[model samples]
Target: MLLPRPLLVLDLDETPWHGELGEATQVTFALRPHLGFFLQAVAQAYDLAVWTAAGNDWLQAGLQAIKHETGVDLAAQAVFLWDRGRCTWRRDEAGALHFRKPARKFRARWLRARYPRERILAVDDLAANYACGYGHLVRVTPWTGAPDDTERLDLARYLLQIAPVPDLRALEKRGWRARL
Candidate 1:
C-alpha cells in the first residue's frame, strides 16, 4: 500500500533564494541550479510547501518566475505557501523584524489535530526558524546562488535517503546536512 507522502515545508529567501529582503542592501534573486529536478523528485515522495518570511508580493512574483523559468509549475508542486503575513513576528536585538523563529507558524495544535507529527518536516537554513520544530528540522546550508552551489541537489538526495524512514524522530538530534 502506498502511504501518504510526508509534509515538507521549505523556506524561500536565503534558503532557496540568495538574499533576505530586510538584511541585504541589494537583493539579488536567482533559481538555484537543479531546482526543478529537485522539486520534482521531492514531489514524487513528499508533500511540499513554501514558507517564507518575505512579503506576499515578493513571494508571489518569485514563485511565478520560478515556475516560468524552471517549468516546474510550483503552484502544482507545492501544497501551500506561507508568507510573512501568516507569521507571528517579533523584533531582534537591533529592533529589526524577525519572523524566522515562527514556531507557531507550523500550527502544531491545529495540524496535529489532523496529521502525524512524525510525517511533517521543515527544511530551512536558519535553525531559528525551527524554534519549536527541533524534532522536525532538516537544516540546510544557506543558498548563496553561487555557480558552484549544489545545496538543492544535495538536499534532494538526503530527502530521498530519509523518505523511507519509519520514525523520523528516532534519527539523530542534530540537523540533517548534505555530506560534503
Candidate 2:
C-alpha cells in the first residue's frame, strides 16, 4: 500500500498575500481568485495547514471567499487555519516582535506522533518562524501584491516535484524554486 503524503504547513500574510493586515484593502491581496485554485491543486496531493500570524477574524472572510470560488473548502481537506494564538512569540535581536515558530504548537498535538520531522514541510516568507523546523522549511519571497510576482506558480511546481519524496528534510534548499 502507498503511504500517505506529507504534511504541508503554509504561512499566510506576506507569503500568500501582500500588505499588512491592518493596512490591507481587498485589492492589496495577491492571488485572490487564483488562491483557491492553487490550494485545491496542492490539497490533492498533500495534507495542508495554514499557519499564520494574522488574527482569526481578519482571515475568515478571505478564506470563505476562496472556498466559494474554488469549491475547495479548506476545512473539508482537514486544513487547519492556525492563527497568532497558536504561534510562539519571541523578541528578535533587533528587539522586534517575532511570531513565527510552530514547533511548540506541533509538540502539543497528535501531529508530533503521527508525522515524522522528515515528512513535514513549512513554507514561510520569514525563516525565523520555521527556524525550529530545521530541514523542513521553505523560504519564499514576501509577496507585495506585485503583478510580476510569480512565486505562487513556482511554489506549486516545486511542491509537485517533492511531494513523493520519502524524506522532505533531506531535500536541499536549492532543490525548490520560490519565484520564476
Candidate 3:
C-alpha cells in the first residue's frame, strides 16, 4: 500500500514573497525567484498548506497575487490556509509582540488523522515563528526582492529529497542549505 503524502506547511512573508507598502491603500508584492517552479515541484510529493502570521486579508491578497503571477492556485490547492487568528501570540525578550505556529496544533483530531507529526514539515525564514516546533521547521533565508535568491530552488530539492523519510522531525534540518 502506498503511504499518504506528507504535509508541507508554508510561511508567506519573507519565505515566498516580499510585500512593500506602496501607498496608503496599496501593497506591492515581489515573489521569490523560482517560487513557481518550487511550488509545482514540491506539490508532486507533498500536500501543501499555508500558515502565516499575517491577517486574513493580507494572506488572501498574497495568495491571489501568487496565483496571478505563477498560475498556481495556492488557496485551492492548500489543505488549509491559516491566518494570524490561528497563531499563538507571545512577547519576545524585548516585549515585542510576535506570533508563533505551535506544532501541537497538528495533534488536533482532524489534522492527526491526515498527518502525524513525523509526516509534517514547515518552511519559514524566521526560526522564532516556529520556536515551539523546531523539529518541524525547514529554515530558509529571508527573501526581500533579491533577484539572485535561490532559496526556493534549493529548498524544493531538499524537501523532495527528504520527503520519503519516515520521521522528518528527527532529521537535523538546520544545515539544509549545505546539504544541497
Candidate 4:
C-alpha cells in the first residue's frame, strides 16, 4: 500500500485552541467542538500531531476530552509533540530575550528534514510562520467574535476534506473560494 499520509504538524494557537487570551473561557478552550470532526475525518487518511504554545498537559487533556466528547481515538495516532519545546529564546547583540518569533524557524527546518514526508504542513495565526516557506502553511485570522471562531473551525474542516495532500499549496487554495 502507499506510504501512510505524511503527518500534519498542527499549530495549536488560534488555529485550533483559543489563543493565549481566551484561557478564561473553558467552553472554547478545548478545540474539541471546533475541530474534532476535522481531525477524525482526516485521521482516516493522515496522522495527527499537536505543535502549539499550549503546555503538554493542557494539550493532552484537551485531546482526551475531545475524544470523550466526540468519541474519536486521536491519542492512538499522535506522531509528534513540538508544543512547549525550546523556542527562539535568546539574547541578541544587546543581550535581551525579546522579539522571539512565536515559532522556531530552526526547529521547523529540523522537523522538515527529519520527517520522511515529501509534504508537510503547519497551521497558525501569526503571519511570521509563512516566512519559513514550509510546503503547507495555513493561518487562522484573529478570533474576535462568536462567528469568527466558528468560521475558522468551518474552514479547518474543509482542509481535512482533501488531505494526504499531493499539493501542499492546495490547502491554502481550497479555503479561499469558500470564503468568497
Candidate 5:
C-alpha cells in the first residue's frame, strides 16, 4: 500500500502574496511571481494547507483575490485554512507583540494520525514563526511585490527534490536555494 503524501503547511501573508490594506477595509493583493506554477508543482508531491497570522477577514479576502487573479482556488484545495485564531500570541524580550505558529500543535491526535512530525514541513518567511518547531521549517525570503523575484520557482524545484526524502524534518533546508 502506498503511504500517505506528506503535508506542506504554508504561510499566507508575505509568503505567497503581499496585501495592502486600502481605505474602506479594501485589500489589494500582489501575488508572488510564479505562484500558480509553484503551487501546481508542489501539489503533485504533498497535501497543502494554509496557516496565517492574519485575521479571518484578511485571510478570506486574500483567498478570494488569489482565486480571481491566479485562478488557483487555494482555499478549496487546502486541507485547512487557519487564521490568527490558531496562532499563539507571543512577546519578545523587547516586549513587542508577535503571533507564532506553534509547531507543537501538530502533535494533536487528528493531525498526527494523518501526518507524523517527520512527514510534515512548513514554509514561512519568518523563522520566528516556527521557533517551537524549527526542525519542520523551510524558510523563504519574505516576499513583497518583487516583480523579478524567482524564489517560488526555485522553491518548487527544491521542494520537489526533497519530497521523496523519508523524513523531511531531518533534512537541512538552509541554503536550499544554493542546492538548486
Candidate 6:
C-alpha cells in the first residue's frame, strides 16, 4: 500500500535556529546551518510545518529573516504552525507538565479526524510529550547555534531512512524492494 505524505514538524529553538528561540534581537547564525539544505531535501518528499512555543509574530519574523538571509525558503514546505501549550506547574517534577515541547499530538487529533492516513514526524530538541500516532516520531538533539552540517546530515539521513518506508524489510533489509 502507498503511504500519504509525511509531516515534518520542526522546532525553531535549538534545532533550527542557533539558540534563545529565534528572538528578533538576535540574528546571528543558525544552530544547524545545513538546516537549509536538509529542509530543501526533505521538501521534495515531505510536508513541512513549524511547531514551536514561540508566538506567531516572533515565529514568522524569524523564519522570514532566515529565508531572506539564507535564501533557503524554509517556510515554503510548511503546511501548518503550532505553538506548544502551557501546562499546569502545580504538579511535581515530571508531573509538572512540560507541555512546551512541540508534539505531533497537538495537530494529530485534527490530522486524524481530517486525514487519518497521513502521519506526523516531530523534530525537536527538548523532550516531547505529544503522540499523534503518525507513521513515526523523531527527535534531534537540541543545539545552541553551532552551525554544523555533519550532524545535520546525519539527522536528515536518519529521518529519510526511517520515514515513508513500509514494513521491516524497508528498514532492516535496506535494499531491493525499497527502490520499487
Better of 2 and 6 by TM-score: 2
Error of 3 at 87 (Å): 0.9
All candidates: TM-score: 0.83, 0.81, 0.96, 0.63, 0.96, 0.69
What TM-score does prediction 3 earn? Answer: 0.96
lDDT of 5 by residue, 1-180 (tens): 566689999999999999998898778999999998999899999999999999999999998988888788988999888999999987879999899999888898998999989989999999999989988999999988989999998999999999988888889998888888
Candidate 6 segments exceeding 4 Å error: 20-31, 85-97, 101-110, 113-118, 131-136, 167-180
TM-score of model 4 relative to the true fold? 0.63
lDDT of 1 by residue, 70-120 (tens): 787776767678888777667889998766545555556766553466777
Query: Which of candidates 1 and 6 reaches a greater TM-score?
Result: 1
26-139 per-residue lDDT for model 4 (tens digits): 444545235666676666666677666566766776667667777766567677665555334456698855322343342465565644434556655665545545345565
lDDT of 1 at 156: 90
Model 3 is weakest, by summed lDDT over 10 consecutive residues, at 1-10
- What would the C-alpha RMSD of candidate 1 be, to one decimal place? 3.6
* Candidate 5: pairs in clash: none
Q: Residue 60: error of model 3 in Å?
A: 0.4
Answer with 4 or 6, whichever has the higher lDDT. 6
Superposed model 3: Cα runs more than 4 Å off: none
Q: Compute the lDDT of residue 132 as modeled in candidate 6.
A: 30
Q: Estimate, for each residue in 1-180, the C-alpha lDDT of model 3 and write its tens digit.
A: 566679999999998999888879698889999989999999999999999999998999899999999999999999999999889997879999988898888899999998988899999989988888899999888888989988787899999999998889999998887887
Q: Name the regions of candidate 4 deviating beyond 4 angstroms.
A: 1-4, 19-33, 90-117, 144-157, 160-180
> Regarding TM-score, does 1 or 3 come out ahead?
3
What's the TM for model 6? 0.69
For 49-145, candidate 2 gives per-residue lDDT tens digits of 8888877865665566556656766655654678888887888799998886666566656776666667788888888787776687888777767
